[model samples]
Target: MAILMFISRVISLFLMVVLIFYKRKEPALLMAWLLLLVFLPPIGCVMYLLFERTPLPRKAGLFLNDIKDERRGRQASVSLNDKITSLVHFNENYNSSRLYLYQDFMYFADGKSKYQQLFKDIEGAKQSIHLQYFIIREDEVGRQLVQLLTEKAAQGVEVRLIFDSAGCFGTRLKYFASLMEAGGQVYQFHPPTFRLIGLNYNYRNHRKIVVIDGRIGYLGGMNIGNEYMSLDPKFSPWRDAHLRLVGDAVWELQHRFLKDYYMVCDHQEDERYIKDHLNHYFASPLSTTLCPMQIVSDGPDTTTDDIKLTFVKMIQSAVHTIQIQTPYFIPDSLFLETLKIAAYSGVKVEVMIPTIADHHYVYRTTTSFIKELREANIDVYFYKGFLHSKIIIIDEELCTIGSTNIDQRSFKINYEINAFIYDKTLTRQAVHQFQLDLENCLLVDDSYEQNKSAWIRFEEKVYRLVSMLL
Candidate 1:
């Protein structure tokens, strides 16, 4: 018994040392892991092993290394206006994403319209179609998408898809068998291993991207599910934001898809084959219009949280107004503090979130942050229905639309992509949409804090304690 106790003590000490030395983690996250390790040795060690290990294997970096030099060379030659150039330099320097001038842009404020346009683009695909989504239900909408892709595949179009294993847990493999039979390929991101145990459940592919015919692209928060279409009665009137892109921007989206595809499919093709295929797919004619834009992506694969840093840059750069819409608002301390600073600096900061939540704990935890935000002079508004849009607009000249949420899960855990648009016309359209959404929102006043019960407050504390893991 003494020997066994000594072995356990050694293991505990090892884990404590590992937690303390883990680099790049926030101080609070490090402390939380340390507490878990000290209090619950066995369970915490197992949890750390399964979830907090290396987020992305070192081998994953090789997937995109072949094109890095070529892309950087091309980006260096692109010219931009003064305002757009500054933003581009920031992203290129900090986020490592290059800016491209898109010819056309279309914004969708609802899933129905987004899906309509997506299907139209898919139907017109002549060469290839690439799609990636977090969730793809086996419901009516999913069936229709599968059918369409299968038909396109049958017509000799290259159709490839990727879905998150955790997000599509309820979706059966049989639902996609027909597409596979029709010569299309489907891959699941980070599927369960070890006999159905998901070790990578903490990291998910939450990006929604569709590139059709190597010329048109779509992305945003709307997933391929009935819930996003308001067909799920539980969360009806789903409000989301999506964008359609046509021009050089599609190439970046294509590059992102190829990286993800190579990682999942484990393609062993030679470098020559990869280079040839990339050149062919990215050879689409450039658009005549020059609308400044940048496609930024971030994931657990890298130590730097580029999307979160982009958010901070947006807040810091805003001079007059900052508007945001997200389904979840359980932000990290840095995110909250940045917004507070922006508001205190005389910027009109407006944040809109859903009054009804699909995740109860997430909603409650979001409510817990309201008191602090209001005290900082930030305007907080709750939409009457579920608002699933992830949008941010600053000064009516810059805006971002994508799958990233204002929560720890999106900022630090999941894979995300956003399109930063630097155009007055598009920004004005986004601002108009934000104003329209304000009609459906109720601005929270001082009474919001006074009405919370003791149980709710306790629950908030408990949820906040583990918010990093959530």
Candidate 2:
């Protein structure tokens, strides 16, 4: 048996190395895999088989994106060169759809108030409505919102909803039965089954978008739960921020919602959802002028990874400063390199991560980055309270705010969306809040190591290795 085990290990190791080279995965990661397979052949083979060569559901998600409308195909075919020429300061392709309707924008500073605004929006919806969330818990907050969605659907508002499968797995399936009964449609994105057993388990739909009457849209990191609203007994006084986007951007979010809707529900649009319901609020040359915002989304299906590319572009083009606040800070090699180079070049980079992480492992990895970043002269701030805001302010002119966090999961795995803003007023508006949050934060520079226990730092090092998967 021992001899046979050795023979099997040799065969698997040979195949794994051959496949890794053939696939052309990152050189460093491939080397790591080679080392892992040499020592732990069976486990490494399983990992590689499940991910790099798992030719089933993954292939399906890759080749089988929903068909875009004929209108969309035509629009997509057009060269955005004209739009690009006007927005020469920033990449024109990153600009938001000029025709997408968004009028006003509101910043929800308090997390709980986001839910309050949601309830009011639901109450006021006249016609069609679409709402999507990553985590739809069965807790107090979830039950209340579910009941409300049912009521709205019953009123013939064309209500539809969706949630992430893994995120809502613990919540009882029966809790949402009312939604179906009221002609409400709810579907889960990338539901985990026996088939999809791999590293991609972390790829979640992190977007929190609520579109009403094709008008008002809300999105950001805040999920639907009492913990987010401080109604959950487990966590208290939830602190987070969500953006209320009105005008042309709302349609883009609505378009995003429908894409997910089609993926999960496979339902066709109402024929005229766009004709009558769409309210394209384009920016004028002055009050609104080509504010050039793009609703960039990233996930497992695409190779480009829009959010990650956007980060790379912004970091590469940054002129003065970059401020980032995220719940989790587990970026891969390229992203980390970007930040290190920006800081090393004196770009006044500041990153605010929670002093105490919601996920303990995430917190550990974040501190490890802090130790390195502080060494490179980047400002690191720790918030005393739980910080759930996910935003980036660059050069006080370009800003990004949305549900996406700066982590591997958000960049390469999760179905996340963000609004990239170029307008100076919006940047200032977000930066003002960032400044206030900075006031509440404790800076860590030249002294973080002296205050920590050696054992704690050791734990952080161990956790940092797993951050790629976390």
Candidate 3:
């Protein structure tokens, strides 16, 4: 009995040391794990040991070595700065696609507009329509969208749909089958039947993308649900942006869609996706001078976390004021430092978030970060409405508007896509729109700083402790 007690003491001491020595990045999580181990004894200890150990892929050095070959080399080779000045900096270091094979144009500001446009595109499709989304509900919005997609498939549009297994789990299985039987090729990304897939639940396809006729494309944060359309009435209106590319970027989206399709369907599209000497797909003579843009996607398979790297580089390179509009502000240490540095360097840095959160705990975590940011001279604004837009305008020289958020889920967990535009005209247009939105926005001023309620202030302080994991 004494020996067992001694061994237990040794283990406890070791774990306590670990809790401090190896920073958890998220402090709230560390305390939770500590509590679990203290009360649950051997079982909690084992659980903590199994779960807390950083997964192989997330460990810093191991990840870099794994993708060292696929690093910036593959991406930096394709540069078109001569065609687009905004890409001048990126061009100096990277490469870009040689030529685009397809093009499509689309424009929608909100879910109602987007879905309505999506249905029309699907209905008009003659050859094929590829669709992918992070979430699709059986609610009014999902059912209505699915009904239209089914009819389009039945009409021989060759529709193919892919949904993340975990994301679509909330919807009925029968609904998925109905679409498949109606000629819609439905495949679940990382299906549960495969053990390799079940290994991690966090790596999800959080992208919402649609491609029709291999010509037109749509991609952004808008998922298939009533809440997104403001039709649910339960939540405030969904505010988001989606771009319709009419130039070579459409082919890049097509390539990504096919890549996801093949990744799940397990077949190479060598003949179809080949860089042909003959050039079959017609290029739209529409000069990219219109809105020269390229779609960049980041995922687990990629050589580097390009999306995260892209934002970090862009923020660091900002010459003018940086305006960030993110619904969630749970940034990692690197991003947090960049923002602080930006503010201290005389950049009029401003961030707008939601005053009332759609998600409870997440909002708590957000408040903690907001306080720190407010202290750092980063003007923080809380939209009275649900500000769901993920937008960034830096120096009026660069603007990124797309599905990617500035939270942990977007940066470290889910697959996301963003359109980095090099057009000064578009950046200014977006910046002006953002400023207009800020008019209705209330800044978290010195008033909130001076006398926030005890309960709210206490809650925010507690939330900050755990902001890393949130």
Candidate 4:
């Protein structure tokens, strides 16, 4: 028995060494994993296997390989006014995402308005309706969505839905049974089978998108849940932002949905069947409006953090002011330092985060970061209500709104998508909304730190230490 125990210990130590050195993770993340592995060997190994050590889904890998040759020959041309050429070119070169000129834009600052518009669009769908969300609760909102999709499918309009398996864990299969019976296809991204366990829970599909007939697209922070509509008593008056876009930009959104749909449903025998049916969705008629936009996406599948780099570039290009709104504010070192540099360069930096705690660890980490920003003379606002909006406006010339948050999880882990809008008119509207939201926020200054007790400060330090994993 003694010899057997010694052998087990040696094997575990060897595994830990491999994990610590072989994985090319950030220093902070590596240290966090190392601490876990050393202090709690058995539990840490399970945690690492469940969360940190998985690759992209196998079907997604195969799909990417199949498209590699086709994508390599794809053109990088886009029609954009010279005013936004530099920024558009930067994104194009970074991720090969083409800039598209949209005809019209509708901004929804709350879920009620956004859902209303989305339902109307879905009701009017002619050929197809594609919907994807991180969360779809088994609540009234979710039922309504399923019923609508069922009706549309029964009417002979092709409908496809995708939801993150972990996000909708509690939702039973019966909830979507009726929709499937009506010929609507439903896929749960990264569903936990017995063989897979819950290994992919950390790498969620955080994107929220809906494309209708390949002509109208909606993308932003609002998920399909009653809580998002402020119907849940636990989180009433929910704040969020979503956009309804029409024109060539919708083509990009449709393309994204197609790729994700194919990846999720790649096991189907007729792989090219859906592709052929949806080929018409990519056709874009000429549009006259000049609202330039790019849909940027990133995930563990790709090594490059395109959205994070884009955020840094936006901050570096800001000349006068930077305004941001997000539910969470646990920024990584690079993002934090960029904001500090921008603030020190005579640029006004303003950030708004929710005062309420959705996740205790995240809330504590946010407070710590807010204190750091305050010390650097960067303005921080604690919103009175729960602010779930993810928005950023730079110099009233560029704006981004979507599921990506300014945090480590969003920057390096989860799958996220954002709309980079480069139009003065749309940007000014976003700026105006940010200013209005300031009315419900309390500014944090140097004195804010004085109220923290020694115990709370220590707790915050501990939380900040493990925030990268959070």
The prediction achieving the highest lDDT against the true structure is 1
* Local accuracy by lDDT, each model: 0.83, 0.70, 0.67, 0.80
lDDT of 3 by residue, 1-470 (tens): 77875676577667767777865445656666566556645655555443342332422222222222222111223444442444544533442422332333454557888878777777787767788988898888788878888888888777878888888888766786777888788888766542332234446787878877756777866788887777665467556666666555655666566666656774444333333311222223343334555567766555455676667777777766889888888887788889889888888898988765787777877777876787789999887777777888888766777778887768765667887776676678778767877886898877775686888878877666444432
Which residue pairs collide, candidate 1? none
- Model 1: residue 120 alpha-carbon error in angstroms: 1.2
The predictions' CA RMSDs to the true structure, in order, are: 2.8, 4.8, 6.2, 3.2
Regions of model 2 farther than 4 Å from truth: 1-11, 49-102, 196-202, 231-237, 266-291
Give the C-alpha lDDT of model 2: 0.70
Q: Give the TM-score of candidate 2.
A: 0.85
Return model 4's CA RMSD, one decimal.
Answer: 3.2
Give the higher-lDDT candidate: 2 or 3.
Answer: 2
| Predicted structure with the largest TM-score when compared to the true one | 1
Give per-residue CA lDDT, model 2, range 1-470, as digits (tens): 78966875986767665756655556665666666677877766676545442222433121112222222211222223432334333333543233331246777777567878888888888776688888888778888898888898889877787878778778766778988888887777777644433544445778888888766888887887777866654444355778887666665677677666656654334434434443331111112424546677756666656777777777877768999988888887898898889888889999988765577777777777877788778888987677888888888887788888887667766788888776667789888989988878898867678888988798898787554433
lDDT of 1 by residue, 1-470 (tens): 67865665677678778667855567898888778777866666666666663556534436465565465322325554565677778998988777776458889988788888899889989888999999999988898899999999999998999999999999887789999999998999888654222266667899999988778889899999888888888788778999998888887888888788876886666345556676556756457676778889989888788998888888888889999999999888888999999899999999999988888889888888999999999999999889999999988888999999999889888889999988888889889999999998999998888998999999898888777654
| Candidate 1 clash figure, as a count | 0
Poorest 10 consecutive residues by lDDT, candidate 4: 65-74
Q: Which stretches of candidate 3 lie over 4 Å from their true place?
A: 1-107, 191-198, 266-289, 453-458, 465-470
TM-score of 4: 0.91
> How many steric clashes does model 2 contain?
13
